[model samples]
Target chain A: MTAVLALLEFAPGTGATTGFRLVDPAQPHLTVTDLAATRGDGIFETARVVDGRVQALEAHLERLAQSARMLELPAPTLPLWRDAINAVAVALAAAGVADGSIKFVLTRGIEGGQVPTGWVLGLPSPDFTRERAEGIRIVLLDRGYRHDVAHTSPWLLAGAKTLSYAVNRAVLREAARRGADDALFVSSDGYLLEGAVSSLLLRVGSRLVTPRVDIGILAGTTQADVFNWAELQGFTTGYELLTPGDLATADAAWLVSSVRHAAPVRAVDGVERPIDAELTARINAALDGRID
Target chain B: MTAVLALLEFAPGTGATTGFRLVDPAQPHLTVTDLAATRGDGIFETARVVDGRVQALEAHLERLAQSARMLELPAPTLPLWRDAINAVAVALAAAGVADGSIKFVLTRGIEGGQVPTGWVLGLPSPDFTRERAEGIRIVLLDRGYRHDVAHTSPWLLAGAKTLSYAVNRAVLREAARRGADDALFVSSDGYLLEGAVSSLLLRVGSRLVTPRVDIGILAGTTQADVFNWAELQGFTTGYELLTPGDLATADAAWLVSSVRHAAPVRAVDGVERPIDAELTARINAALDGRID
Candidate 1:
């Protein structure tokens, strides 16, 4: 709504990036302050930008508000943020890329403040190989973050993306250090949580399953949408607690997210497995055959 | 060490002020970043400055590193950070304010890069209260931070100053909301963790006791130094797990920190009690009879 462009390298009104920028509450200025860069007090979302529209925008917006609530933050004004994001997408669209991932990060702005004003919008850095569709190797690592109320306690921002993501970054780094493409976070109790940047979805005997939300797993928007679409696609879906063994025995595995969509999990701990063609077909159908 | 000066109207390193400047890290230039106006982070410490020296500076350094570690950060180089702190202290001393508190804040720097880097520093603003020793009315709050993991997770950088301190700020606000001066954090299981900014110490019988490190309690430098001093004063000191009941029924209770070396807890949760005499004697003797 403000109609100011803080970052370039993308068109506006269509999400082509997987990043976000914060708006100053009082001014049109954008600043990266101590609130998030240092403390990681924020939330983020990644949604698809298809034909200048943020796909599943409402779900992403709702997730943002829920995340804010987990952090005990006042729910951000969705309409205003939407306008800001839309403006950036439109700008990016005009520049070149029309359809891509939109990364939105919301951080607690400034020092000593509770409300988040620090936001960033940008395309995700081009890192993941498009070959991920075939499958990617993921290594499991211990995050040491317990699932108790302190860490797992529901906050307006708990499931919401907060900027205190150093642990997530560290987890990813550790995974890479172990020669894996991505990291699967395991709770202190040895339960596989989720990937650092994506949600884990496994297919077992025609059932699409992921870890339950109560298991301290983030309520992933992409995974949720996939689940919803799965129901419509005549596939039985369930949310249940999962262990590595359960994942290992799955007919097929995949990590779901906004950018990667339904990238298949080809190998676990170097164990190669056959891809589940039927499940992939349903997921691709759910994506409307767009990911390629 | 980059020498720096803060222009403030109130006591040198105490209360929050509207704005302050730091000697620019890139050059000798001075730039003002108003932390008070920002409220970006919470729970800062200003240690005792004695005769152009920061008392137990290494301990404070250790605490700062520990805090950073808890927040899962790349440890700020001790010598460089210490140099900056000492520079500010030297500037303050030149302005003739030594033998007071040396302020330290762990704040997120300016935001905006893929990883933002905008750290700032300043001396205390006005309104700093230096009371020799005052009985404090304390309240206990449920911070939801795991007292065990939050208290003693070895990896969490416990006892270190971190920037994800909104909870600490919230605890103080909760205390103020309840008409208390400060707040104490208890685990979900009811173990007294520590004060919002300081560590907890109590005397059970003739032994000075605090929670052990593994209880998720912060390893308090001030308390540690006091324990060492207690040995000199012929008092047996031990660090063990403490619960609220243990605190309430203790022979005496005191909050230990850099500024408030040992403030007797007179009334906890409106249950008034007498001050612990032996605790006071050891504290006073440790301070060489000069508390204020």
Candidate 2:
């Protein structure tokens, strides 16, 4: 028998303990008619768990609310989400998980239903230790949109971070097929966007730069936290319109996300790029110190 | 208490009659862990049922297969899909639904599961009779991609009809807010693509023109069927790159889909356009005659 991936699960409004249900990951839970299942009409957030504590819980909750608003879904209360996450976190700790990830999802509910369906699941954090230690080889894939698309086309839901991530997943698969560890999506008109599962971060001398969120990319919480700490450490932080050329010329580049925190980009499109081991360490440490 | 929308639900492989389990639409049937509800990693098809017969059933199945291939999902055999559709059709007929729609979905299944989860649902066809009679007002919205996006970027999954339709749904909602009936998506480079929920068809002079499928648009099964029949009826059909101006100058325009057949466009962006009632009737007749 295969081991279940999800160690803990919680669904609100279900007749379970504390309005959260303990679900066996092996069984079917979601009906086939859910709008989330059928139309990908939903929002989700994945936050890291460290020593039984959810990292950047407030930030994740705020982003979730923003995503829900962008999807025109009724924003779920922070308390409801907090309680559910706590419930799942408790269960994960009880299962002896010291480090893991908690994923919260709010779907448009079943088709024809008015209320949204919200749930939280806790799973073991993926082993990104190697990437963090040795860095990653990435390829720049075209995201097929100009940088100004998000500003002109709001319906594209550019930065909303909805559940329609099949494209993102596919890009990573393509990267793997091409003998790369991950993919960094560049805009059609030659601008660096973000990564499939992480945000683009570049270090050039004492300056730290990331792409502007207004250019149709998700606002990376971890990137923001690292930038705040970097600024205090005498490193100038700025948001700019970057390109593939910018990535190739940078002293170092890293993909930053909540769970992995910061994974350095050691190469681009199979070409070996510069890697600042000390800088990567400092940034990861800064992220770790700030995220609570 | 409000009534549930789905009339009949069928999930294969569950212990039930005919490998399908009857579901109560009001209750939650999906677990919190299904990838379909979480990532929207799936493909779907909606086919019309006229007098208890699924129209364009083979075409829909073929498209579903194509979409699954694009998503790198294991395609289910035709016989399996046929059995599931037959089961749902029987259930719908038993419920006295002579004219309805059947929606079949194939999700990537749970987070770590290899087998895909498939289901069929039957619902009463929406009353598009009024729209088909009086026609519909449509707004031209930017799809935020160039016409060559699909050819240049396969990761965008442009031609594949996946479950990530939130943006499409949002476009229609925006159209409704703008006092329009539907939305026709124009490419970022000023080329007519397709409709939010249907394909774009225009009657210009003696020729019938539809946007080329290479323009990051789902190849319309209904449009293909209509064009095939139109050729036999002395109408020259061609695929070309079209613009909104072309739509404004056409003698008639339509948003065609399997369930609604062909709905004539009465206006584009609040500007009234000519509607050829005779042409619409003839085209719909052709579609009805060809689709089985």
For residues A158-267, what per-residue lDDT tens digits would candidate 2 score against the true structure? Answer: 88889888888889889999899899998888999999878999999899999999999999989988888889899999999998888989989999999898999988
Instruction: For candidate 2, write residues B190-246 as lDDT tens digits.
Output: 999988879999998889999999788888989999888888878899999998778
Q: A137 in model 2: Cα distance from truth in Å?
A: 0.9
Query: lDDT by residue for model 1 over B1-292, one digit each (tens)?
Result: 3224332212222322223345333232111122211223222345665445566778777776666555444444556556656656666677566545565554332221112122234333332233224556788765444555643333333455555454555566567766777778776566788887778888776688887766665678778887887787677988776788888898778777776667788788988877865556567557533322
Consecutive 10-residue window with the lowest summed lDDT within model 1 chain A: A1-10
How would you encode candidate 1's per-residue C-alpha lDDT over A1-292 as one tens digit per residue? 1222332122233223323443332342322233443344556676766545666777788887777666655556666667667766665565565555565555555454433443435342343445354677787765554554445333312344654454454455555666667777666665667887789998877688888777666787788888888877677888886788888888888888776677787777777777775576667557644431
For model 2, the superposed segments whose C-alpha errors exceed 4 Å read A1-27, A289-291, B1-29, B289-291
> What DockQ, between 0 and 1, does each candidate earn?
0.14, 0.59
Question: In DockQ, how does model 1 score against the reference complex?
Answer: 0.14
Native contacts kept (model 2): 0.73
